[model samples]
Each structure stands twice: as C-alpha cells, then as structure tokens.
Target: MSQQSNDEQGGQHRRAILQVAGAAAATGLLGANAASGQTARPGGRDDAPLGARLQGVQHFGVTVQNMDRAFAFYTEVLGGTEVMRDGDFKGAPVHYTLMADQEIVARERRVDPRTIGVPDLKGGAQRLDVRFVQFENVVIELLQYRDAAQPTGSGDSWAEPRDHMSPAYPRSMHICFYVRDDVNFDTFIADLEAECARRGMTQVRANRTVAVHSEQERRAAPRETNTIKIHEGPSNGWSIVYCKGPEGEQLEFVQVLGPVKKTFADAAEARRAATNRG
Candidate 1:
C-alpha cells in the first residue's frame, strides 16, 4: 500500500482503538483490554456507554516548509511513520503528512507564516520555512521563516519564556500533551531528555508548570489547571516541561492525574462529533 493508504488505514485503526479504549475506561477497565489487545464484542459483558470516556489521541496537524525533508527527519530521526499526505488548512491546497505511533501523534505541513499573523513578512517579502512534530499526543509546530530581504536573527520570534501573556507581541505557541500514567510519562520525558542531551542541546527550563496564566482563561476566576512541571517531583499527579525542537519551536509536555476523554475517533469523527453537539 502507498504511504497515504497506510495513513488512512492507520487512522481507521486508531479510531477503533480509541472507541474500544474509551469504552474500556468508562467501565473502570483501563489497561486490561488495551494491553491484551482484545476488546469485548458489541454485545459482550465488557461493553459500556461512550460518554466522556478516555480515548487515545487521534492525530495532530503541523505546518512545515519542505515536505520531503520533514518526512525524512521525522521518520528516521524521530522514529515516526510517513503515514500519508493531506491538506493542511480548510480549502487550502497545501498538503501535510500524518505521523503517529503508540506513544505520540503528529502532522507536518509547509505553511506561509503570514497566515499565522506574522507582520514583518507582509507583501510577500518574508518566506517562512517551517515544519512541525508532535509528541506524547501534543503538537509542536516548528518555524523557520526567512525574509528574502533580510538576514536571519536570533531570539524567539514570538516572545520570551514565561507563563503569563504580556503586551509584547506573541512570539510562539505550543500544544500540550497529557499522559495516561506516571510510568509511561516519566519514561517518555527521560527518553526526550536523553535525546536532547546526546545532541548537545541546552536543555531549557524543565519545570512542573508554567506560572503565567492563559490569556483566554484570565477572566474566569479559578482557572482550569491542566499543566504540571516535571522538575519538581515524579510522584505528583501533574507534571510539566518544555523543549526546543528543530527550528526552535517551544514544545511543552504535560502529565495530568486521572483519566482523559478522547472525544472523537479520527479527524472526521471529531468533525462529526462537533456537528452533532452543535
């Protein structure tokens, strides 16, 4: 089968896996069926309602500059599969590749930075060279936009590292991932830390949570606490940390206690669910 076909098949498999996993979690049977790879038939004793159940991550969409290079880097270096190619944004002709494994999910695409609200590149003078890689069920978008008229400079294109949003222009944004269990969570963090160390990269701030409050939730007193920092301790119910990926995109890793619900089977499932809910 072609890569696209493989991706399609894998996506379907992932959907079924999420539904089974969700049903399992709702009935207080978390790891039993997933580890065993055997789920109860439609009318079996193991079946349960699928309301607010924990579903595995479906997939993530990322933006990139060169599809070929991005595909090679993710598949070879990051240990992901070049599953398939599809459109990036709605109605846009740009294409992206979906990559996933048992532990993480990601999508890569070549995008124009201006579309994301970058002002310096107005009038088509700035050409953004970018790609994205998501880990642990979270998306990490990588950017390398170049102004054909200017030289490359240093410093985060978005903003300085902080939890609170300031008046300063937004420099970067990141997608956070919440792990299912502590053992798997720590293992994944250690692996990523080791990989960064081996590459001689300076490990940035490794904390349990970002102190800055989310702008979207500022008005709501008692903000929803969904983040944790790993540097504090391992036994804690929540853990949070950040890493810099290729082209310097801020990658955040989070681990929250209790189970999380996987809303939809695939991207299509998610769309359908949204429509139904609406």
Candidate 2:
C-alpha cells in the first residue's frame, strides 16, 4: 500500500485500540484494578521503569494567518479536533486547539506576532497569530505575524511563519519524525518521494549516515556552510535523511531501532536503506 494509505491504516488501528482501552478503563477492567486486586492512590508511585513507562508530550505552539482557515485545514486534512476556544495566553485572548492519538495530545495555541521574539512593526505592538496541531506524540506549531511591514522571514507558503523557519539560509533548521522499522521506513520514504514527484516537487540528494565531521571540524567550518554527517548506529537498523516538506519546511525522516525509537536514527537508517536499494 501507499505510504499515505499505510498512515491512514495505522491511524485507524490506533483509534480502535484507544476506543477499546477507554471502554476498559471506564469499566475498571484494564489498569491496576484489572491486573491486580489493589488500586494505587492518586499520584502514587509505580514500580515501572522510566523507559518502559509512557510519558506524554505536553504542547507545542504554532502561528498562523487565519485561525478559521488553519483550523479547517488541520481538522479536515489531519484529523484533529477543535477542543477549546478563546483560550488565554499571558492574559491575551488565544485559541487552544487540541488533537490526539492513543499516545499523545498535541495542543495548538494562537499567538500574536509581538509575543514572539521578533520586533513589532508599525511602531506599535500587535498580537501575533499562531496555531498548534498535535498528533500521536507530535506537536506542530504554525505561526503568522500580523504586521506585514515588520521584518519577516519566508516559510512554507501553506504554513504560517512559526510552523517553519527562515529559509534564507538552506539547511539551517529542520524537524524530524521517527517511523516504526526499516520496512515502514522504506515504505514512508518511497511514498513521500512518489507524492513529491506526483506533486511536481523536486527531489534533492538522499544518502545514508557517514562520519563526515566532529565537533572540532564543526568549529572550524565556515560561517555560510556546514557538513551534514550521516552514520550507522550500533544496531544499524535505524537510519536518517533530510528533505524539504510542503512549503519548504526542512524535514528529517528517521527509522527507529527498537520498539521505541528516535526520529534522527530512523531518518539516518531510511536514507541508508534507500541508497542501498537504489
């Protein structure tokens, strides 16, 4: 199946699991009460290890132009929900949108341009526009500034300023996402490449990890340029690669090693595997 299709399937599977789990919880049939005779008090400690336990991601903020339009895009295209309205940030009226999957809750908040660490234009203070969208442990912030006269940077046209970084200098900043394993990694990369081609987006270089530099080399590196190092991990199952997502957002796709994985490692492995297959 296509990568998008796979993603849809995975999402459906997760939603089903969550539904079952939620039902079980409501009936006291899945947690400590179900597994054991005793129930721990609220805020009580458990014997589970940190690594084995599930920790949730709190929230990430993004800026956007029109809250109505952005909200529609996220909810219609990305399967997010409009949880709260007219939320407050620093006493400023803001919108708080929440999206969730089985594993995490993504909280999106709108911000005024003046609130971000940028100068206010028009010789006056104005609120910035921001939006947050979260999905399955991932939080994406979309930012849009109110004042056009202010010194602003470019970003993926579809996304607001805060959703991305200034692309004036290429390879300066990027976001990464981790995949399950090599098979899923390969599927995702292929799917993305195909989608880009279909959408007429150009394909840049793709490769595996290698020892290209160290901290010393990085220090000596020129101001306008830097090396992108790709190297194999201990298990060699996970990999990494960099690419530009819609609206020119620097994105890194990582293939995770074990059950729980990191986006960087996953991207490195995916790049490597793609290179080898090619």
Candidate 3:
C-alpha cells in the first residue's frame, strides 16, 4: 500500500479509538463488570439502582513528602500495621498523559488531558513510593512523590520538604481513627498527646466530648437503624481531637465511650416484612 493510504488508515483507526473512548468513559466502571459478563444478581452486593451501585469505602490515599518519616509516624505512634509497599506503581495510560500533558507520550498518543473523569493532574511526579497501612477495618495509603511540580506553577520542581495546604485550607483532607471500645479514652488521648509533643507536632487540639446526635435523630433510631450506623456512641456521645502529623498532615482521633449502641436490625427486618405484606 502507498504511504498516503497507510496514513489515511492510521487516522481512521485513531478516530475510531477516540470515539469509543468518549462514549464508554461515562459508564466505564459499570461497563467493566458487564464486559466481563457479570450482571446484577438477586441479593448481590451490586444489586442496586444504576447510579447507586456502591459497596463501601474501600481506601483513601494521601501524598507525603517523606516516605520513611510518614511510615514511622503512622506505624509507631498510631499502631497501624504496614501491609504492603509499592516502590513503583504502574498507573493507567491516562495517568502518565495527565501528569505530563506537554510530554511526547501525551502528544504522540493523542490522549486528551480533558478526559471526563480526570480533571487535571498537577505536578509531574517523578517517582511514586507508596505504603499501605491497615488500622482495624480500614487501610490508609501513604504516597511519597519524588520531584513533584509545584502547585503554584513556579520554581521548577521541589523534592522533600515541599509545601502543603494546612488542615483549615480548602480541599485539605484528614483521616480520623476510632479509638478502640475496650481502651480508656483518656489514656488514649494522653499517650497520643505525649507522642505528638515529643515529635513536635503542631495544631494539636482535643475538644471536649459532645453529643452530635440531635433529639430528632434519637427519636428516629427505632425506625432508621437499618439504613446506617445510627447509634454509634454512648448517649453522651464521642470526643474528637486533631493534630499535625509528619509534614503537617492533618490527623484526627475519635473515641466513643461504652459499647457502641446497636443498630436495631430486628426493626429493619420487621419493616421489610411489613412492606412485603403491604
């Protein structure tokens, strides 16, 4: 075939790929299950309204400037068990394209940086060092990005000792750990405060326990327990405290005194039966 013919065929192929990507990108995750011949089975975890097919909170990640320092803080101070570490995480093709939008990989591959779900990936991260630390039922991921582009779009790029938004800053996030039911709340706070003080942690504040549940909520619990973890703590409620972790990462601890109030599963079951009978 002639060079012109080859070029024309390549253009057609590329156009086709872009068209399919644009269409399927809207329902990409759900389509993955269908693509594998998995449909909504009765009583299955995913059996729900199309847009509401969510199971639960899987995990959350935060980017840190120093991996080892953050690792020690989470593991030693918080008693989190380090489960896994990925020195180099092989992200999707879209990840590289978004990170370096002006690079050859993005330009040559015809990857649109404005793909629906991916808003904008700031800072061209050189290397991704990740560690998974599990605490009770949840896992927290610690990410250390080497030589990241400045969010301000100034001063080339910075490595360790980089800047971050404080806890009060918009979009700044924090992870709150629940104090064990068996442990004394005051003792937990004392140990944590001492550790943070030793490490020179900033912005440490432990607020007095408050009853967050309103009178309306207390009255509704007999009927509403099925949908959520309604009655979590004692009638007096829980206490919350905040501190700055390594690199000023916002940290939170919550303690609910006494055995947590049970969600009336029997009430929910009776409600379901009534609905069926009706």
Candidate 4:
C-alpha cells in the first residue's frame, strides 16, 4: 500500500480507539482544532474572534522537583499511559531553554526577591529533562531543570495559613480530569484515595465528592457547604473533588452526569433553543 494510504489507515485506527474510549469527552478536552485541521495560536487578540478555529487543551506541562516520584504518582496511582520515559532525545543531552526578549517570564511571574530566588539563565540552560504521559486525551509534560534552580512547589500551600492559596487567588491554576458517571466513580475515588494513602500522599481535601447546583440557586446559597457551585449549566449535575499532586500542583477530578458538550457556547445555545421551543 502507498504511504498516504497507510497514514490514512493509521489515523482511522486511532480515531476508532478514541471513539471507544468516549470521543466526546476526549475531543472536548483535547480541542477540536487537532481533529479539524485548525492551527492553534497563543491566547490573545491574535486568536480568531469567532472562536470556531479554537480547539480544546492538547496538553499541559508541570515542572517537577522529583521526576521519579511524580511519574509514579501519575502512572502507578492515576493510571496514566507512559508515552516517553525520562530522557533527552538529542544525542548530546542538551537542555532546551529560552528567555523572551524582555525577560517576560521574570516579569509575568512577579519575581519577588524575598519569596523566590532568581536564576541567571539569560545565557541559556543545559541538562534539561522532560517526559510525557497521557491521561486519556490529555498529555501531561513533566519537566525538570537539571542545572537551573527550580522551586519544588509554587511556594503557596493550603497548610500554611499565612501563605495559603486557593482557586480564587490570582495565578493559581489547576487541571481537572473527567471520570465517567456510568462507571463506579465512587469506587474509583476510593481506590485512588487508598493508593495515595499507601504512598503517603497528603490529601489536601479529604472529601471525595461535592454536589453541584445551578448557578442562580447556588449564588444565593451559603458557600461554606461541602457542595461547590458550577457556573456551566451543562455541568450542573456533576460531582467534583480536588487534591494535591506530587509536586504540590492543584489537581481535580470530576464525574460528569450530563452529556459532555464540545464547548460551553454549544451547551448555552442548546439551552437557549430549548427554552425558545418551550
């Protein structure tokens, strides 16, 4: 067979696998740009205004203090498929580092001398290590700066009252994984919690699941309760829980009860049309 034919066959096989594993959630999480042949641009005014070309998240990166521990937690505990083991693909084992024209990272990170130290990688860095792991549709790039001075955590811990950080805090970001509502999600959480306990991982939030209510009703209700309010109307019936990853990165797990829509716009439009029909 021709190379083009072989490539087409390979793509079909991969799509079939994704379909069996719940293509809606996968495509929604990974973004339609990949499947639709749309090029993704950096988030800003440069991006298409209509957002039709926009795809979902392809992968996210996390800098780890200890690669082995993080790898174990993600793979052994969370069942992430290992794509590439820790290694440098380049024959010389070079560290790929870049500094923006205006030292953009330093400025954006708001580097405070008292809180964080600075590494003079202006010339460049070497011995950089990275690995890739796939959790269903999402690919997590685990990175480590071998020679450069990289902090272990974000320096804001929930345990530390003075330096505590929450989702409400600025620059605090998190990643969420989707679990099927039809499957034994509760059992899955239990097993995960047990594995974490076995590995001596600190569960920041002991509660496994939180009930969600609609936006309007939840807005009026007290916020101290165990349940969390979800603004996405399509995600109204889902249950969610939060936990701390190996490197103190915030992680979340969501069990969705409603149909997983491709985008929030689509979900909102469906609700609007339904109301009009009614």
Candidate 5:
C-alpha cells in the first residue's frame, strides 16, 4: 500500500476506537447506578441493572512511590504473602495498554502531561511496576508509575497526608483488613507499631482497643451460640487501628471477635441472598 493509504487506514482505525470509547463513557453513569444496587430502569429491563455479581472484596489497589519499601511493610509487618511481582510490564501488551491508555487516545493526545492517572478515561499512565500480595482473604496491589509525566507529591496526588476524609468527601475510600479473634489483637498491634516505628512509617493511630460493637453485633447474630461470643472482650468483638503505607496511603486493621460460624457452600450465592435482603 502507498504511504497515504496507510496513514488513512490508521486514522480510520483510531476514529473507530474513539467512537467505541465514547459509547462506553456515555454509559458510565448507568454503570455507577447499577453498582449502587439500583435498577435504573423498571421491571429489570435495564441493561445496567444492579446485579449480584460480586462475591466479596477481591483486592484493593494503591499507587506507591517505592515498590521495595511497600513490599517490606505489607509482607513483614502485615503478614501478607507475595503472590507476584512485575518489575516491568512491557511484555504484556493488553495489560500495559490498559494501564497506559495508548490505544484509547490518538497518538497526539498521549504527549499531553495533563493526561495522567486515568487510562480508560482521558489520560494515560506510564508502564508500572506492580506487586500483588495476598493479605489473608484479600489481595492488595501496589503500583508504581514509571517515567510518567505526573506529580510525585509526598502524599496523595493533591499532596495531602490527612490519611482520612470527611464522610461527605466524594473520594472517600479506605481499605480495611481483618485480623482473627483467636489471635491476640494487642500483641498484633504492638508488633505492627514496633515495625512502623523501626521503619519510620507514619502511625496514624496507636494501638488502642475499643468496644466498637456490643448489643448491635449480638442482635445481628443468627443464633444464641454466635450471640454468646459477641462483646465478651476485646477479642470477642472488634478492635481497630490505622496506619499509613509506604507512600502515605491510609490502611485500617480490624480484629473481629466472636465471628459467626455459618459456612456457605457458595459464597456468591450467599452474597446474592444478602444483597436481596438488603
């Protein structure tokens, strides 16, 4: 083919991609509605109706500055197991493109520095060094954007290390991890506090045990046996503490005491039933 023909074909392909992206973007609001358990349309005809597809929290992600430091804190301090690590994601085209948004926008827009943080929306991110660590039942993904034209603030992109937010804040989201009631919450907190002190990590809240739940938990229990365990002690209910990760990302550790003993054959089924009841 001639050079002119090749350029024209490329332009057509780019335009087609943008068209599809625009359509998906238009449906963003409906998707949010569905996620919030609302049927945007009546009689279940809504294509984006809320579905009980989610079984449980699979993972939560945080963007960090140093992969190694984050790994140490999560693995050594929090008792997480390293699942996988990708120092460079160049070989994975689909994953890299999804992260970088090279295909979402035309080549010209990619050079714009304003296009940062978002890959599927309007901006792109540099190829990242990603690490996945399993913290008990949930996985935590730590990401570091490499060579991206983005701000390297000490804290969040806004450079605020508040580590918390008001309930009214639209961007308020925090990852909470669970600790076993059988395990001593005080000992766990003491060890983690010592680790943070030694490593110079910001300890948002010190080791403190509070009666976070009492009658409410007992009332919620399905059986008398489960109720007997509720609020018996610091280990029988819940104890919580807050700490910052390598890049000042806020995390919470929760100790659930007297947890129910019901077992479900299918977690998804239980989740769906819970959703319906809610």
Candidate 6:
C-alpha cells in the first residue's frame, strides 16, 4: 500500500502505508517501490527473473485477531521491537492495496473480494491496526482488522490448538528463526514455555531438536567456496525444532554450528562491483 496516497479511489482518503515503509523501500524489500506501489528493478539490469530480482524479504504479513495480545507476545517473549505502528487504516489506501483482491477465471470460486469492505458488518479491518516489529534479522507485520473472519482462538485461553489445518494442506505456511549460539535449543524451549506462562500468554511447545542430515544440509547450505562445516551433515551440529507461537503461529528454530560466513548479500554486492568494473 502506498503510505501516502495522492488520489482517492471513490471518495475515501488513502493512508500512508508506504510512507511508514521507507526502510523497506531503501532496503529493496520485495523488489517493490513502496512510494508508488509498483515493482522495482535493481542493478539497472534485467539479469534475473522477477523473483530473482528481489533483494530480500521486508516482513511477514500476519493478520491477527488481537494486535495487543500479539504485540505483547512478540515483543516481551520473542525479543522483537516495535519499529513502526499505525492504527487508522480502515477504508484507506491500505485497505484497497493490501486487502483488496482480484479474481481470475482459472482459480476456484469465492465471494467477490470487492464486496468485502470497511464498515463491513460481519468483519473487515475497519479498525485496521498495523504494526512492524523488528527482530534481529527479520520483521513481523502484525495486523488486526475490526470484523475479521473466524478468529484463530475460542477465547481468553492459552493452549495448543484443539484443531488446526494440517501443514499438509496447501497454503499452510510457517516462520522459522535461527536459534542463537548462546541459547540451547532444549533450554530455549523450556524457557519459552515458562515465559509464556508467566506472561499469561498461550503456552508454546516445541517438538524436537533433531540433527539436520546430509540431504537437507545440501539444499540449505550456502554455495560459496569459503564455506565451513555446513556440508559436513550432522557433524555440523545443525539441529531443528518445530513449535507453536503464542497464538498458534507455526514456528521453527534451528541451530547450525558455524563460523558465520559473509552473507550472500555481501557476496553478491562484491560480484556486482566486479562486473561493473569489467
């Protein structure tokens, strides 16, 4: 959504959704032009496919039923800092841009998205609340709309979900984070659950922290010559666990024994400089 909208759709004023995302724009998030609501082309070259042209992810969009609850859990429990927040986006540019959708004939049938509007009696983000929380390397975009669809929970209770769509189902997605070297996976899980209890948030559970094997390592390892133990399989000390976030958000944590290599972005920048010189 364009943070500062210059025009109105019908008669509603547009919110500055993009305005608040200046950091993302400067950092090449999603390869999008935040100010203009368009795609961006990097390197002054079309050397890559549209997807490859992307530099990095800006944030994960999460629609939550309770922004306050979600905010507390992420900040207090998960160590995220609120970077930017805006709560008045209903019927604004953000609504049309981020929430609006168009239909394609090849797709399945559904209620027309255009009909879903602000001031919607049933549920919409009439009271649109948006928050950007910054963790070490990733950002979480937490959103809450006024009248939403069936909420993810029943009420003021905290427990593993009684029922949920299996990850096997299409469109199911999860977020993963790298467990810090100073933190033990098992201890992290223990502390995580304990923290939630103290905060009166939903208790979390992590399944296992098994070693990452050869096959998985090959796919996930960085493809650089200065590489270290990543290719050595379980000997690399890589392990992972799956868990549920405070509000049942799917999460994964991994630990890799490593002398962290230069990030791919840094490597790519060097390559770009070399190419430009040549």
**Best-matching candidate per lDDT:** 6
Tens-digit per-residue lDDT, 57-160, candidate 4 = 56688766667777788888878976654322111112112224234545777764223332233222323355667877677877654443433322222122
- Can you give the lDDT of residue 272 in candidate 2? 68
Best candidate, TM-score-wise? 6
Better of 5 and 6 by TM-score: 6
User: Every model's Cα RMSD, please?
Assistant: 15.1, 16.1, 12.9, 12.7, 12.5, 9.6
- What's the TM-score of each model vs. the native? 0.35, 0.38, 0.52, 0.54, 0.51, 0.62
TM-score-based ranking: 6, 4, 3, 5, 2, 1
Residue 45, candidate 6: how far off, in angstroms?
3.8
lDDT of 5 by residue, 176-236 (tens): 8777758765566556655776887653334223333554442233322221124543344
- Ranking of all candidate structures by their lDDT, best first: 6, 4, 3, 5, 2, 1
Candidate 6 TM-score to native: 0.62
Off by over 4 Å in 2: 1-57, 61-127, 148-173, 196-235, 258-278
- Residue-level lDDT of model 3, residues 1-278, one tens digit each, is 67865565455445444533443332232354656878767775456554345423445677666566677778987888876664432233334433554554556767764432222323224434557777775677776645443322112213434366457668878888887668666566656656866876433333333432664443233321211122453433455566556656677776654343222345557756754453
For each candidate in the order shown, give its overall lDDT on alpha carbons. Answer: 0.41, 0.43, 0.53, 0.53, 0.52, 0.56
Q: lDDT of model 5 at residue 33?
A: 58
> Which tens-of-lDDT digit does each residue in 128-165 have in candidate 6?
55678888777888766553433432223211233664
Compute the lDDT of residue 5 as modeled in candidate 4: 52
User: In candidate 1, what are the lDDT values of residues 228-249, reduced to their tens digit?
Assistant: 4433343444566565444333
Which regions of candidate 1 fall more than 4 Å away from where they truly are?
1-125, 132-141, 147-172, 180-182, 203-205, 208-238, 242-249, 256-274
Greater-TM-score candidate between 4 and 6 = 6
- Backbone clashes in each candidate structure, one number apiece? 19, 35, 0, 1, 1, 8
Model 2 TM-score, 2 decimals: 0.38
With a 3 Å backbone cut-off (N, CA, C), the pairs that clash in candidate 6 are 2-18, 3-16, 3-17, 3-18, 3-19, 123-147, 124-147, 125-145
- Quote model 1's TM-score: 0.35
